[model samples]
Target: MPVFGLHIRILGVALAAFVVVAEVAYADPTPDFFVLLERAKAAPRISAGEAEVAAAEARALQAEVGPNPSLSLEVENFGGKGLYQGTDASETTLSIGQLLELGGKREARIAAASLEAQAVRAQQTRNTSDFAAELAVAYARAEASAELAKLTAEAVGLAEGDAKTTRALVDSGREAELRFVQASAELARVRAELVQARAAEASAFARLTAFAGSKTPFDSIAVSLLSREPRATAVAGGTAPAVAVAQAESRAASAKVTIEERRWIPDITITGGVRSFASTDETAVVAGLSIPLPLFDQNRGGSAAARSEALAASLRLERAQSEADADRRAALAGLAAASQFLSAQLEVERASAEAYRLAQVGYEAGRVPLLELASVRRSLIETRRQTINIRLARVAAEAEAARVTGRLPFGE
Candidate 1:
């Protein structure tokens, strides 16, 4: 009987230690930065990389202008029949000419390409900004989930302890069997919820790992980096998003119009050749000039098309500006609302602290049973979860605000 009593004491001590360890763990949840770092690694997709490459290509496009001059050599007279056949006689001639843009064609083409390159660069910036914003939001969500999971796990642990104590009381004729059953059911529910939370955390971490692609598990994130990258997102969200591209396309369209207008003039092609006959040993040189008469195709259609595109580009630029303004307003609203909610949530948490203390006192005095104590404890854990959510919401809202305002939270 003494040995059995000793075994019972050891078991009780182990259970008590387990509870203490769980509470300690819940008090401060470790961050999962490894998940977020993974997200950052794969943030920019292949499509965005292609956009950057296209911008680079546009810069290179400026080098591609009118075609280079063509050259050729011939000995025609010697290969000709009868009169033209002069195997021993020859005449050599050389001529060179280049096609130049008569109007502002070349200059316009270069300007348009340069503008297009700028627009592509802006697109790249926009993409990167979006990547950072997404990362911040996801990081907030994961933190919230982890904290909530820890809270829920603690609730389940408390509920399990209550179940064992209530079962013992019921066997001793102190508590009813029904009360023991109720406690068990509550413990099961909390356990189920904790399982679900763990699953959610895993999913969140998977996504974070995919994007950040880092080896470090999160102890904490630079709340500043995750807080908001205002300036960067704002630049992307600003008129710069599509402006460069629009300007480039517009310039290109204008260049096309200019090229078409130049067609109203004409092109002058000069050709020259020399001939020889071997039998008569005769040699002669001939030269001629050719020009096209624009009696019908005056490039009227091409010029009209070019003008229409430029007009379309102007409209698109205006639309992009309007969208950016709307986005900024929405982001600001989110940030303000989140801040307000976080403050209110903290007040609610203070109210719960007193309730928790009273409930614990009542339970020890035996005025309130284990079940009641478990209920109040669960409520406290849930309230803490609410606080975590509120903070996460604030973090997310701040990130969005940063995205819109184009300012980092470094100073503010």
Candidate 2:
């Protein structure tokens, strides 16, 4: 018996220590939203966009370089029957040739490539802005889910207390048995809602951690993003990233048109070399110039195609500007409407909370019926849920506004 007691005491100590360690491990502080945003900036998709910009810059540099010189060697009159059969009768020539571009073709190419790089850079900017907005929306959703879980858990606790109180009253012959049954049913319903809310919270956190590219998933955010008020600043359409991208593409297309128009100008290839005649035992310097006549292909079709593309680009730019204006206006309007709705919902939540408290007091005093108290409790829960949804809607509208304005969502 003494040895058995010793073993039991040892096991109890080990279990207590394990429980303490588990609690400490699960007590990690919530993650900061700004830190998560920084991590998201380094995500693979954003890095891919940066790589595209680098590649475009490299292409621009390549366009600035002139064509490489060509070297050639020719041996003549050496493979023939009589004089070409002997090395003494052979003629050898070594030459270096260069193509001299005309009609500012090289300059045109450089301009076009540089503008193309600018367009790529603009597109990258737009992509970064869009991703930031998406991350903000994800963060908001996670925070909202967390809030919903907390609210549901509180409702479950209240429902459990109500059921216990009704059971006690029924046992004492104050409340009827049916009242206790109703309270138990309501408690079960709130418990089920709590389960659903927790599942949604887990899913939202998973999405948030994925967006942040975190190896260890976060369970909660440090700050409540849904609680923050959205900024109501007016954004200009001209300053939007989409409009900037379109403008850059339009300029690049115009540069392409210039390149195609200059394509009809012939380039001159100049060759200079030394010729050796073995029979005469002599060497001479020779130079030649070759020009391609634009007889069959004058690049007229290419020029026409480039012009058409440029026109299309111009139209796209105009469309982008119009869409940006409309989108910004719509986002601002949505934000305003959501703000108004959230304000009203907050008032409703307060009123419902007060009414539930009074109903609980009255039911305990035997002045209020179980059904009336349940109705008030349900109203409070629904009002709180609606408030959460409204807050999320407001955050989404703000994120959209920030995206259209080329600003980071929920960022300074």
Candidate 3:
């Protein structure tokens, strides 16, 4: 080979290797949402944060009441008195004392802390529910988009085959030229629709990735399909979100009331010492009770605040119950409706398949017009797509109901 030709061949080989490596290095562009959900469940980051807050509150509640003991030593208040000659003046005094909380204040404080911990932990569980619901929405959307694309692909194939057949018949002087042109035009229009459908699919996939908080898109995922919409044959109750927050608030409010009641009580302190004034040495003992008198400030405002909060908690619980009932009814209705729709689509699917198969056989046998065959092909594909969509919607509805009511209509 000529020297220049050898260089060109070597460069082509290098380019091919580079292309292969690039393809191999390429990662999925979409995020795997199911994996992310698993991560969220395992880490339960919200729960962890709640746990930390609860721990802090518990520590505060358990903290022993009173000023931590204080210790002091003095020789006339310091080394500045070092010049003193008398023993009494030279002697240093040392004392240690601790303040004490009164009126069972420590126990009340601890109780309040415990309530707060419970509230936070409940909030964490609610967080999990919210995440799960959101994941369901994204999954549903992706399935919808994929179904749309599948339908469009089927339409394009049908249209293209018809156009080619018509063109061949026209060339043989067996079909009108206008028919061929019409078929080709329909094929072009359907192909454009297919492009849009794929774009929609991409958009849905991208959104799923964004919601999942993942670095790489999922390589592939298998989604559960539903033959019918979700229906709760069983009585439905509220999901974890409503239940958790209500319980948390109620516990917290009760805790606050107790803490407020303890507020009126005061703390105390004790100390002992020796004193010398010029002529005689004397030992002195002091005991004191620090009583917080509520004459001017009886904590009425705080106690009232706690009472209001407790009342609010009651209302919240009631509201959650009402919402849950409504959700259950809506979900059950949707499932029943979806089931009927799926049944209807089943007939459409079977009819379309039979029509397409018969048309294909006739077209090849030169026993049918190309336009008829093309129409059947497109109808079959579109029908299948529609059926897929119906099934996907049913699954989505079921998932949504399950998520809302905390139980599947039929069962998880």
Candidate 4:
């Protein structure tokens, strides 16, 4: 073949390959609910919580270490005049001193630090659960938006068909020009609505992908989460993450009080050394002990403050438990109501769909007016929209219940 002909053939082959690849990519299935949840776990906020837990654990380890010993050297009577001057009258001592913690101070400190670490871990758990619940709600919204977009697209198709039929009737002198105008207007309106619904669907998917820490936006989900029956039906009886966090904090505060109560017991420092006398060229062993007297600073105010904080923590823990219980009950009730509403709406949607079919048939047969057909179509669309909303509401309630019960919104 000529050079120009060969170039054209190569370009055509490349274009064909590109088309095939695009088709395969478009046919790829979207990620499922569990995959999205796993992606969410890798979000920055969740990673930050994990880092906090690790930091708390490191601090707990540091608390287990005791105070270090000190080494000191002292020289006296070396720079004075006459009898106290020069090296002949000098005295030197070298010593090692260690502070001995008293009244179980070290033990109390370790306990308090350990309890604080536990509190941090509990808080991290709460953060993860809360984020998961939020992600679940976002997923439901995205799925609902996609469904709405599909429904509106179908409505547009129906409107287009009605417009075409009316145009034909007008041309045949069977329908008035006003009827054709109305049909064209309805088609335009539904097309506009379809455009808006598609935009909303894209926005919802983008938000969902961002929440999941995904760099690539998802075009659609593998399944409709709102359409699936929620699996979280068990009563919320377990200790919620919020309650667990509060309980850990309260225990940590009580441990702090114990540490403060023991603070008044002074630590003892024991020193052992060798003393050298330059005047007689002699060396002697020496030992000493020191303790600080609690004359003014006995930690009385500190103990009182710790007690107050502990009391406050206890109250907070009580409130958290009560609130968790109440929230769980409310979530369960809301889920029940939403499920009932969804069931009733589904029935209405079915009946309305059948009514629209009959209206279309009657209108084509010249037995029904154009206005009546339009009204029936509007009713069907509204019923379908309400059903989608109710399904989303049910999913939200399920997610809330799962959050309060310290469980994943979907099954493991």
Best by lDDT: 2
Give the whole-model CA lDDT for all candidates, comma-separated: 0.61, 0.85, 0.66, 0.84
TM agreement with the true structure for every prediction:
0.75, 0.91, 0.75, 0.91
Name the regions of candidate 2 deviating beyond 4 angstroms: 1-30, 234-238
> Tell me, what's the RMSD of every candidate?
8.2, 7.6, 8.3, 8.5
Query: 261-338 in candidate 3: lDDT tens per residue?
Result: 778776666655554343345544434344556679878889999989998998898888788777768867886787
Cα displacement (Å) at residue 403, model 4: 0.7
* lDDT score for residue 23 of model 4: 34
Residue 254's lDDT in candidate 2:
100
- Which of the two, 2 or 4, has more TM-score? 2
Q: How much does candidate 4 score in TM-score?
A: 0.91
Error of 1 at 156 (Å): 2.0
Of 2 and 4, the candidate ranking higher by lDDT: 2
Q: For model 1, what is the alpha-carbon lDDT of residue 221?
A: 35
List clash counts for every candidate, in order. 23, 0, 4, 0
Q: List the residue pairs that clash in candidate 4.
A: none
lDDT of 2 by residue, 1-412 (tens): 2434544554555454454334334333346656777777788989999999999999999999999999999998886787568687988999999999999999999999999999999999999889888888888888988899899999988888899989999999998898887787777666666666766777677777778776666777787788887777644333889999999999999999999999999999999999999999999998999999999999999999999999999999999999998998998898889999998988888999999999999999999998998899888988998999899999899889889999876654
Model 4 / residue 268 / CA error / Å: 0.5
